[model samples]
Target: MPITLADKLVVAISSRALFDFEEENRLFERSDAATYLQLQRERLEVPAQRGIAFSLVQKLLAFNTPQMQRVEVVILSRNDPVSGLRVFHSAEAAGIALQRGVFTQGRPPFGYLRPLGAHLFLSANADDVTEALGLGYPAAHVYTDSVQASLAHPNELRIAFDGDAVLFSDEAERIYQAEGLEAFQRHETDRHGQPLPDGPFKPLLAALHRLQQIADAVPGMRIRTALVTARSAPAHKRAIQTLMSWDIAVDEAMFLGGLSKGPFLKEFEPDFFFDDQTGHVHNAAQHVPAGHVRSGFASAMVETTATIRKHQDQG
Candidate 1:
């Protein structure tokens, strides 16, 4: 078969995002999320091998037999220990336990393909990944979906994210955490009419927005998006305003309040869910793909995994 363009989807993930979550927390808080992850991947001298999501990304890439294949991993850091390290190294190491020859032989299905330079190709850098594909990749380029269901065929690639701290400014979150309910509500009410500043997820959102623009212009361009948030009504208003300010289109938005969000998530289904709180992530993981984003906040960083785990267990 001629290598048809319809048989593959590309998921770009940072080394840290794919690595072990337990140990990375300390570093995640001390620095920026990307910096923390990049450092973790470099210092550990190993790719992240813990989470189910990491394993799934590897499976999609290595198992090229099926029509739904994936090619993931790209180095985006400018300066770091693992900056120059091979992107495939992480994949190979993680694959060793599964199939010995898989990583070493550079298996036909999934192996280290080649380098995608910053401007030339998306390098897993949120900004770069989004910008490069804004024009639209011949392949489907999605950020937030975990199941990769969005790309049912090899053609479409999907991306997913957890709302709140991931896409919008964590400022509102900070208020909620520090000030408690009344203060948090008051602050949100005060800021109701105004849009929140772009949070860490902005770079990616901008990239998706650009892609949406192109998709709008061109026919048969397969690009999609969703905003799965824990924010409820009234609180959800800011998210809408923020996106409006940026002029980004979210194909779907789920404002899940105190309600068990997992059911809704499973129904909407995403490639991934990025949330700052483990409480939400734990439940969401059971249904759909999920990733935890450490706010790089002191309180969150200070909390031990045991504690977070315990809290989740309790919930």
Candidate 2:
């Protein structure tokens, strides 16, 4: 018999994304590999603090019972093997039950996502995120300074996402960017029944949906998702229709009409939130663990690499 990841919701995350390694990471940034490894070795027994994605990972792992394991979280990091010890230690201290990881030292770690069957990839390193996204994985550049995971909901995993450019294609966004609100509204209104194209996080959403299915039979664990978008009124029809079309359902949806998403996200208290726009992300990060989906048309407006936007339609 052989081990396999098929039929499981697997999340491949970075060491920095899973724990607060900023201080140690700073040491690595300023010094050589030996110095970084030595520092990690010195503090091998000391558990690291929880990073932004900690709560999310912890909750997802809870879906796995003694008899049935529905989720897997693997540490896919750039740290040398010596530095990997603290990561497992930190997970143990947090009671995360994570047992799988791939340590690439300084080499690119995105290549491992394929073999790991990753549904999502969260890394503090933007380059790895970009690479994973390029390789067609749903990857996010976790904003380390964002709001830490909320302790309000321990058993339930709360995840939020932006609609346009985050969950769905930037087609409507392109119109909104090119024309005025009226044109955008009319376009969506005309296409209310039509399903919008899938975005980068759609695959991740589908994977979460599958986990949610498992949670239904499990007693102690649950999954809550929200579509917190800036689109409001008639435009909301298309977003809803798209999810419905895909047979995916979210616990909640906020159509804020181009307003700030911070307060709404605060109320939702997600373990993590994802958005493609900078302003929206910054606002949400102030209230919840946030990640930037470095894809879509809005990202193109920021003068970033066009390659990310070119492959933006992928998940």
Candidate 3:
């Protein structure tokens, strides 16, 4: 029988997203691929430092046990196979059990996300992330320089997500962007009973919810999710109703009503926080590990559209 990832919560991560390769990356940018490959080869025995997404990956991997493997983390990198040696070595040194990988030698690796059945794709390359999101996968551009994960919750994997353009479609956000707060509030209030459409991250959130259920049976394993949004009061009702309609619930919800999300996220101390807006992502990155979900509204939508057109042209 062939092995399958049908029942697993699979995450496809790039080498830069998983470990600290900023220096090597800078070299690759400054010099050439051959020079970068040589640098990686010289440092083959040196384990790479943990990057922004390391803690999240490490915690998720903890869900796996000898009895039953509930999670799978694969290296979906653009580095050549030769450079991949350092990546695998680093994972081993860090005690992360990563057994599968794809080294595309500078080629876009998002194509393999389908074969991997990945629930999430984290990479430092914004173009690749945008393309993956355009393809309807839950993908994010990991902020490599973002603050590291907190040690406060060792046994728990805590994740936080923004509401509009993230867990739900950017429908309300488009309204707010175009018609101002009063109109947006009125719209939400009127449609409080109707569920908002699913966002790109909705699939990833659903996958995490399933993982939470599975963790309930595994001793000492836990997953907690939070909806940290700018929606407040009347607008919050629809967001909650939408999750309820989908039969999913977040462990916590924060409707900040346009308050700066950074301080609040600092208090929550999530392993990772994801938002669609660059401003929110950068602000949250100052306090905790954060990623930008490049989908829905403004620039994200623009990028997604361009990627779709690019693919269509290729096809």
Candidate 4:
């Protein structure tokens, strides 16, 4: 029989996203790969600090039991094999049971997501995330400097997602951006009964939904999700209608209109939040762990590609 990740909720993460490698990353930025590799080798025995996504990964991994394994986390990193030893060591020190990994030695690692059947791809590399998103995977650029997740929801995996772009197609967002608020609202109002097109994160949300159903039989295990968006009233109706059409239900929904999302996300205290807009993601990161979805109407793929090329040159 062949081994497969088909039945599990697989999450592929980068070493930097899963651990606090910012200091080493800074060294990489200032020096050469050899210098960085030496530093990692020197610190091989020390466990890296927990990163912004650490808590989320910890809770998600807890869904697995000796009798049933519901989740699989794979390290999909740009670090060389030597540096990867530290990533695995850190996971063990943190009590996170990660058994699979792919080390690409500074190359973009998104290509492996297809074979992993990853429901989510979280990384510190914007170029890799952008490439994964381009390939139709749910990928996010982890805000490394973002505040860590709250400890309040120890037994629950709480995730929040923006409506447009993150959860649904950027179709209406493009309209909103090009035509302005009044026109966007009117268009949504007229099409309130129609379901919006699926977005990149939809598959991840669906996978989470299935995981939630499976968690029902496990005591003290829970998964809560939210729809946090800037749309309100007329525009909000279509968002809800779309979720209904897809048969997915979120535990909470915040239609913030045009207000800043930071304070509201602080109150929600999600393990993580995803938004396509850099501004929204930056704001949310001030309060909760947040990632920038590099796909949608506001995608900065060109900028990300340039960044990737620059890094490759540095590597």
Candidate 5:
């Protein structure tokens, strides 16, 4: 496909759209965590925000200007009427497209209802991004609970992501998280070199694969993706297997076992880097446009409505 503004897109979103995690059992009435998570799985809605992720995206938007030119944003939710409206209006104010619609939870996104062009598309709704990626559109997922940071202008818009959690399966990671790493490792090791079980990010990976094919056809144009994760050695075995099984191609792979990602990404010079962890995002943003992927099963750090009210009051 032609590298349109739609293709060269950069999105920054709030965490709720990216991941589904419970806010603390605080001001609100509490419910069973498992039941709550189960209910969340069935519904396609934005969860609460992670402060760190939100703050980072806001900082990114601050850097958006005429010099940057073509960039668009979609609030991605009907919830949070006020903030959503603010974001929608801001995009209009800046002459960028702001699409508002109900989207799937975690499937890869396809084309959207907008005129074709080169632009950055961002949203707070994590799940909606899967829709964008399914449609072969590039997007960013963010959270509400995030820290402030600079959104650098990219001369070369390189983007990176983790394969399994960020791109492929939640099954293995979920197993690791609940069942213990050893069990997860053993399960994966037994199934090592086996095909992936069609994780949520699969469609997105296919979309990226399509982009790569297009780039290949046209010279002087490039869209590259890197898989960077903590999975190494025996664990890394599964990731490679999954990629091969899916017939997807990743330009780079760095299996850093519990190491900081910032330094290496600094050298690679990606336009954006996305991961499921706050640590990687925290470090990556210092060097490039950074976003956090919101998974459907993560817990959310809920802030009181009063706190949000206070910020609105200040604003």
Candidate 6:
């Protein structure tokens, strides 16, 4: 018989996303690889600080018990093998049970997602994030410098997401981009009863919901989700309706009406937050462990065009 990942909720994350390496990353960026490798070797014994998705990885792994292996998290990193040594050491110091890893040594690691049966991939590299999304995998570019979530919610995993383009399709965003805000509002107001289409991170949300249900039965852990979007008033209705259509429920919903999401997110203190737009992602990153979902009408529409052209040529 052979071992298989068929039944696990697997997550593939990068060293940068899992542990703080911003200072080291800057060295890699400014100087050469040799210098970075030497530095990593020198400080191999020093465990790195917990990164953006640390709490997330920690909570999800808690679902695994001796009798039931409910989750699997693998280190899929672009860091060289030497730096990877520190990543493992840091995880061990943090008391996380990480058993597998792939050190790409500066190459893109997205290609391994399929082989790993990864339900989600989190990295700090935008290019890797984009590539993963194009392949239709759920991935996010973690904001490694973001403020970590509060210690208050120790037994609970708090996640927040943007509405359109992250959880729901970017249909309304496309409209807003083409027309003005008024037209976008009017459009949603008219069709508030209609559910928005599915977006990239919806499946992840559903998975978390299911995990919450399982945890609910056990009583020791919980998963809390929130919809923190720029849409407000009438436009907010469609986002809510979409979740209803999908039979999804979020613990909190904030329709900020084009305001800065940073302050609100600081108050919410999610373990992790996902948004599509760069501005929103960076803003919330300052206040919470945030990741850019990198999917929407613009990116997805181009992907659709390429697919359509290929199909036509094949036909």
How much is 295 displaced in model 4, in angstroms?
1.0
Sorted on lDDT, best first, the list reads: 3, 4, 2, 6, 5, 1
TM-score of each: 0.53, 0.94, 0.95, 0.95, 0.53, 0.90
Cα displacement (Å) at residue 165, model 1: 1.6
Write model 2 residue lDDT over 20-97, tens digit each, in one string. Answer: 999988887898878888889999999999899988888888888899888889999998888898899989988999
Models, CA RMSD each: 12.0, 4.4, 4.1, 3.3, 12.3, 5.9
Report the lDDT of model 5 for residue 310.
88
- Local distance difference test values of all predictions, in order: 0.50, 0.90, 0.94, 0.93, 0.52, 0.88
Candidate 4's clash total is: 0
lDDT of 5 by residue, 86-116 (tens): 3344444443344543333333333442454
Model 3 residue 68 distance off true place after TM-score fit, in angstroms: 0.6
Tens digit per residue, CA lDDT, model 4, 38-104: 9999999899999999988998998999988999999999999999999999999989999999999
Q: What's model 1's lDDT at 79?
A: 27
**Of candidates 5 and 2, the better by lDDT:** 2
Candidate 6 or 2, higher TM-score: 2
Which regions of candidate 2 deviate over 4 angstroms? 305-315
Clashes of each: 17, 0, 0, 0, 42, 0
Sliding window of 10 residues with minimal summed lDDT for model 2 = 302-311
Candidate 2: deviation at residue 282, Å? Answer: 1.2
For model 4, the run of ten residues with the poorest summed lDDT = 297-306
Candidate number that wins on TM-score, 4 or 5:
4
| TM-score of predicted structure 3 | 0.95
